[model samples]
Target: MEKSYQAAQAFSGDLSFLQEPADAVAIRHQVLILHCLAEGQQPISISWYKNGEPLPPSSYIQQLLNGSLWIRNFQKRQRNGTDEGEYSCAAQNRYGRLLSRKARVQLAYLSRFHRNPQPMAVAEGSVARFQCLTTAVPKATIIWERNRTELVTADPRFTLLPDGILQISGVTKDDVGVYRCLATNPANSRYSDEAWLTLTGSAHLSHQEPVILSGPQNLTLTVHQTAILECIATGNPRPIVSWSRLDGRSIGVEGIQVLGNGNLMISDVSVKHSGVYVCAANRPGTRVRRTAQGMLLVQAPPEFIAWPQSATYAPGDNASFSCVVEGVPQPTLAWLKNGKYVEVRENTRLSDNNRTLTILRVTYSDEALYQCIAENSAGTNQASARLAISLPQDAPKLPEKVIAFPITSTAIQVAWNRPSPADTDGIIGYVLHIRRAEDPSTQETQEALSKMTFKHKLMNLEPSTKYALFLRVYSPVGISRDSGTIFVTTRDIVPKTPDFSVTTVNDTSIRIDWEGAPPSSTIQGYKLEYRKMPCTSFQGTQILPRNQTSFIYYDLEPSSLYQIRLVAFGNSGDGNDTHRFVSLRRSGKVVPDPSPDSEEEHKPTLGLIFGVCVGLACPVLCLLLLFLLYWKRHLCKRKTNEGCGHNVQEEKTDQAIEEERDRNSEEPTELLSVNPTNVAEADSSLGRDATRVKEDQSHEPPHPAV
Candidate 1:
């Protein structure tokens, strides 16, 4: 146990050592050493290694007494590549071992250049490289220099390689210079021999004009055929040639190809290719350019581009027609009407190189079929159109005299002559218009008839009424203007007898009164007549206008019976008569005259009687007295009787009755002063007859007195 404790103490102290020496360098034939120190209780061993490997005993390498490594001579040729490496010394004790820090031993010698840079020749815009090779004891770094100035690697145009190579790209005339490469290390630095660079090509312009070897000429070809145009040029360095159209359009290689010798070739040529073409030649690095022009022609036939179209215009309006044609040779145009050549008229004109025709102030006569004819050396073609004129329509003329007649009491027949043909285009039908004269809106009628018919019958009209009528004609175009209006009336019907009463009666006069007829009857006047009872006709008649409702008759015979009648007249004629009978008589007592004895007291004496006898003896005086008395009494009675006998004729119109009255003398009859009592009795008797007449009419059919 004492020996084991002693061994442990020894091992702990054995690992202690002294510091080693740093790295070192040496020249050829120079001496070197690597050394370390260690202390321990047991014996310590030491070893030497190079680059982590054991070093064997060699003639130039030896170990010293203090455990250090030694190199006697550093010879590069005899070292066999092992002279340059890391060297280390290791020491150990009974418990542990320790390695000293490594130290490097490098061999050094002066540089020896093997090859010098050679002279170089390159064209402008080419690449150049300079080379320098050398041998030395240590590795060396290479550098480039141009024109005695050091060059940096940052320059893009010049680059320096690790093996002493200098390169320059895109060499220009400015880059022509002398260049050198330097080899350098810690021992010494050496430079290669200088070299010169030469550039062969030129980059300057020359003053010379370009020349054309082959020429440019005009070309003509048919449609859809191939065509070729040639152009060539010569210069110091052959000139570049190109083809272009004069209209400034690019020519493609699909249909039009440009050859290397400046020639243009076209396949399937068309009318669009017919234009001037230009060829240009230019030399690089010189102001030498030349140009030439050539024309291309293509043949084609006539083709119609636009044809004539139909047109319509009114009178006094302007019209125009145009036709367009395209051909190699221009086409000629002409105008024709109705299949014949149209000559220039007063208002006709032509313009636009005879391709258009114009008409001014057109008329109805100008309406016709028009044709446009186009002709050329190739062929001829034509187109036609119709031109029409429009006119206004006119109204028909008035018809001839119109007449209307009564067909019945409530209907009428109307007739007229047809209108003249000159005033109408053509009548298709006629129109008859009828309306009531009093109130047009009350009743209206319209009828349409064929063109041949000229009369119409109006029916279903009110009796005793008037109507207004007019006519109109119609055609396919429009209706004609209204004709003159005329008035027509329907026939009037007979009226019932009027009821009359006797107002007064006298010895020779009677007074009677009656009521007016109905308003619808259209009564114009009234008539009254009377005669003795049982007489075949009336002895006297009175004509009264429509305004009078009462009448009186005088100079009637006393104590006599008479018959009376009253009638009403209208637009048609006299209506049925109302009859009556009456008697006239004296109703009062008569008075007597005084006797001659009462007149004797108021008479003259005997002398007056004697005077009267003497006056009577004169015959002329007695004859005149008797003749006067006889004429007054006898002639007046005879005239009165004749007037009463012919009074029936008074029923005539007032105009005829007035003429008869003018022929008679203006004298009063003897019976003009009859008694009022006798007149009143006669009127009363006449009233009874009127009542009987009305009763008789109610039981029988009415008879109108014409």
Candidate 2:
């Protein structure tokens, strides 16, 4: 029983403690607990070990009732690096012993000395960095400070690193100061030595000489013009400016003035002020001086060289007038008509510096008094002329609303109103001229008795033809230009049949070509009709524009004959149709029809006959099979009845035999009472007779009657 118990308590898995101390911790603040388990059996003793040896009892360590070893206030015990090592616990019983895996424990401490922060010198707009290094068991949080005050790392210019490094970006003069770093943790806190930052660059100071930013340049001015000169300068301290003439003359005298910002102004300048001027800039307590100069000029005004003269001209004639001028500075010249400024137009032109005014195709409206004017800065001049027109007579104007009406198929009546009084000269008679616009050879002329009569009949004109007509008035003066041309047309006549030909024909469409109707015919459109051959009436008709010389008819029957007709229509009526016969066949080739016998042979007769015969014979065949099955079943039943009859007969025979034997045995009993001796002999004879009868019955066949 002891051995069995010992086997049950054997260790089965790796031995390890349930709870172990952290790998590293601050001294005097750490505690370690080692809980060990021995499967199946309680340990007889549990103890703690350090460095592979039994640990001596001390105020810092103890064992608990639950097989756990506890350590408190762990500290460094040796100076040769023996203070940190593995710790373990052992549990033992009567069966076996187990030692738990080693758990390491280390005593932690703060660094002994803090490193000094590095001093840095950087140019403005440059980055500066300071470092603080130290040795510690646990990583410390780093803090940056400047001038004894903590700095917020959220500022974009300052950065604090975890390893006690401080960075200042874009360092300016204001960033120069004392910097310090602080490192802290749960064990303790320490600060590094202070560091100083210095900045040096041009951004810290400003020093420059005066620079001329803008100044006046050489210039020229006309007489009686305003002049202005400007000079601008820049320096560390603002500079003062003064203006004077280079010829030792004081400015701001005799209409000359000085403006703020070193600009000189001269009003209504004259020839005396036409000289170089100087501008000077100076700074207080500085010996440096700057200067700029500008020049001026005065010019004379214009004067006339020759005066213009008046002139006369007839209507429709070209005329011109001349004037000339001269001055120190060229002057601008202009022309005025009747005291109003003359503007250049299609009929008027100005040339020779506006010294000459020309009129192109002069009319009554252009007759007026004209003047020439010249001007300059100093003075002005003028000249004048008169224009006129000379004429014998003016052309008669065209009448309004000329109209024409059809009088006959080849004639038209034209009428109009008299010309306006202002345009008509004394007239005696009028002449009418008419001609076909399309054929100028066909023309006619007629004379009327008086110009007052404004009606005439144009005779012998072509039907459906456009004509150009005009009327003119005549007197002692040459006949007036013909009035505006008027176009007129006689009533239309029936169009002639158009000449056409079949261009293309196909199974489904037919294309025809034709020459368009003559221009004189005035045909509006064409009417096309088609029908199958031998048909009386035509199918639907299509109307085509007069310009359409070709048309295609669609949806025609294939392998069919057709008759097509084309007729031209005018305002009067449609002309006679030009007919043609056409056939719609494939590719213009006829395919012969198949023979009737072949068509019939290709029909599906065999499949139809076979299907019909199968449909009718299936029920007859099924009835025959049913009759055969019934006959077979009937024969089987008849045979079964015959077998049963035979079995019944044999059974009846066996029953009879049993009855006969029973009767015989009863007879023997009766004989025993009659005579004992005679009974024995009688019984023997009866037995023999019974055996003989049985053998005969066995040998005999069944009776058919039974």
Candidate 3:
């Protein structure tokens, strides 16, 4: 890097253009110091020779256009002046010292004894220009600074005048501070006392309406080109302004344009322009500026980032759609089948909020690209996202809706349909997941049926409870999303005691059957109960497991109506539902034998005919007996029928028996008369017969009907 350059004074000695210092050198450092006359009135080769050399390196030369030169930054170690020879500086390369040009010094102000610094004023919210007017013995250099920092004109918003005026755009509260002017000559350097500018108002420029604040807003700027984002803000007593990126110190151009207009005039606009930016503006006399941010959104095609939020579901199921997009306006969701719209009957719907599509009863055909569109008043954008519907890669439907009766403590059996609408590839298998309500929420889906459907019976549950049984069905999904939730319920019922009535009772045991109420919980199996004929404690009470409804007690007490109770057990709870009294009858009472004479006299007319037909019925009776022996099952059935068939016959026989008893209730009195003559003879025999009559009466048979 060449640090030195041959110089020519193209303008006044106001080194203002070089806002900051370059390498300012002095006389002691200069190897060439020629105080002699030019020896001629010619524009000499104003070049610098270093280390006593005739010419500085050809590389150490630069033409300062519209620029000036007058050095005064000199101390004991360095020198700077224009005495026709104060323009040289020396440099030492490995080769030795080199001398710069002495004639490079140009003094055009030999006639001026003094110069005044430039003066300017601007409102707090407006632009300002300051002119530097100063003096020196010969030609002098001038510079401007605010708060010790040099100012520049390369700034697009801050331009410089040909005379020596500093132009500042969007003057702010910070700009109200005092400014300093300096003048340097070959003799010495002098600084004018600081000039304090009393600014009354803010310098923040603000647009009234349809304008962006702080940073650019409502941009009507051209597209594709760098846009200068300008904020139009209005605050009482305008403010100072500066531009910056949302996260950085400054934005827009550099050096000459770092802080200007409280805006960043971009060079090229691309898709990246869509973002937020910040700017600082302060009211007059305030150190803290009001900062604001604006967004830069570029119009472009919509980038669709969407998927089926709920992908895995049963054949007859519904799922929600998730759509993400980037564009001017928010996107609208649509269900696209083969790149087209779906009909209303398909049960597919778009959500009112966020426009997410929903598919009910999802099927294989529901797989396709769903287009989302984002459009602004200017144009429209579209994006495509693929949606897939698949079966659960888990177990099949289980016996669901099973719940234990809380009071009965009985379990219920639950079952349900399995997942449908699986991929044509076929289901791998299924597995059943059985758990309590307090179990972990997460469970894996499988492809094995043996594991899927479960004959789950809930236990340790409350009785008299209508419990809920949950079950699900699942299938394989090659590249399918996971199923959300499968749910179903077992039949709910109230708990009741088991009907443990005695079917048969023996001296030791009793055979019993349960006819109790239905169970509430999922009933996977059953149990039997028994006890001693008179039991006071559970120690004597016995319970046996009977897969069937009926159970036999072998050691039951005979002839006792045992106090017994039956209860159904389930997951929910237990309850006593059935009760029975069992006892055996004994045959020990007396009965009289019917007399033969009584049978003859008491027989009804039908009985007389039956007696007469007995001989004739013998063959028929034998035939019937033979038939019954051959077909025992039929005879059993007929025997049951005989009871119903003889109802009317029994009623007629009862009526006949009633009538015969009524007729015999009273007997007629006999008269003791006979013929006169026979009477005398009868009298003599009667006396003798009387004695025998008493003896005969004791042994005589019952008389026949008259």
- The CA lDDT at 248 in model 2 is 90
What residue runs in model 1 are displaced by over 4 Å at the alpha carbon?
1-398, 403-413, 418-429, 436-444, 448-453, 462-468, 473-482, 487-497, 501-511, 516-525, 533-539, 545-549, 558-561, 570-573, 583-706
Question: Candidate 3: how large is its RMSD?
Answer: 43.5
> Which 10 successive residues of model 1 have the least lDDT summed?
1-10
Name the lDDT value of residue 330 in candidate 1.
Answer: 71
Score candidate 2 by lDDT. 0.58
Q: What would the TM-score be for candidate 1 when compared with the true structure?
A: 0.26
Of the pair 1 and 3, which is ahead by lDDT? 1
TM-score for predicted model 3 compared with the true structure = 0.20
Better of 2 and 3 by TM-score: 2
Q: After superposing candidate 2, which stretches have Cα over 4 Å from the reference?
A: 1-209, 213-233, 239-425, 428-506, 510-553, 559-582, 586-706
lDDT of 2 by residue, 1-706 (tens): 0111112113332122344333444455477565654443332445566776666556566777776766675666634334467665554332223344455665555684456777887667555667787776666777888898988777777755445656565678878899887778766788788889997664443544555544666766667877777565555455677777889965657776654445577889766776788777777678877887777666655556776654545556787888788754577888876434688999899998788898888765575556676766644445554554443545444455567777656888978776666544466677776655433223356556476677877777787676666666666644544455566677666667776655334456666677866655546666666655444345545556666687776666666655566766555444555666555554442212222123344345535545665778876765665566557656765664443321111222323432332343223332221211122342233323322211012112322220
Q: How many collisions between residues are there in candidate 3?
A: 120
Instruction: Report the number of the highest-lDDT candidate.
Output: 1
Better of 1 and 2 by TM-score: 1
lDDT of 1 by residue, 462-576 (tens): 8866666767777765455445556667776644557665432456666667786554445555657766543334535564655567777776677655566676654455565
After TM-score superposition, the amount by which residue 174's alpha carbon in candidate 1 deviates from its true location, in angstroms, is 99
Model 3 residue 300 distance off true place after TM-score fit, in angstroms: 7.3
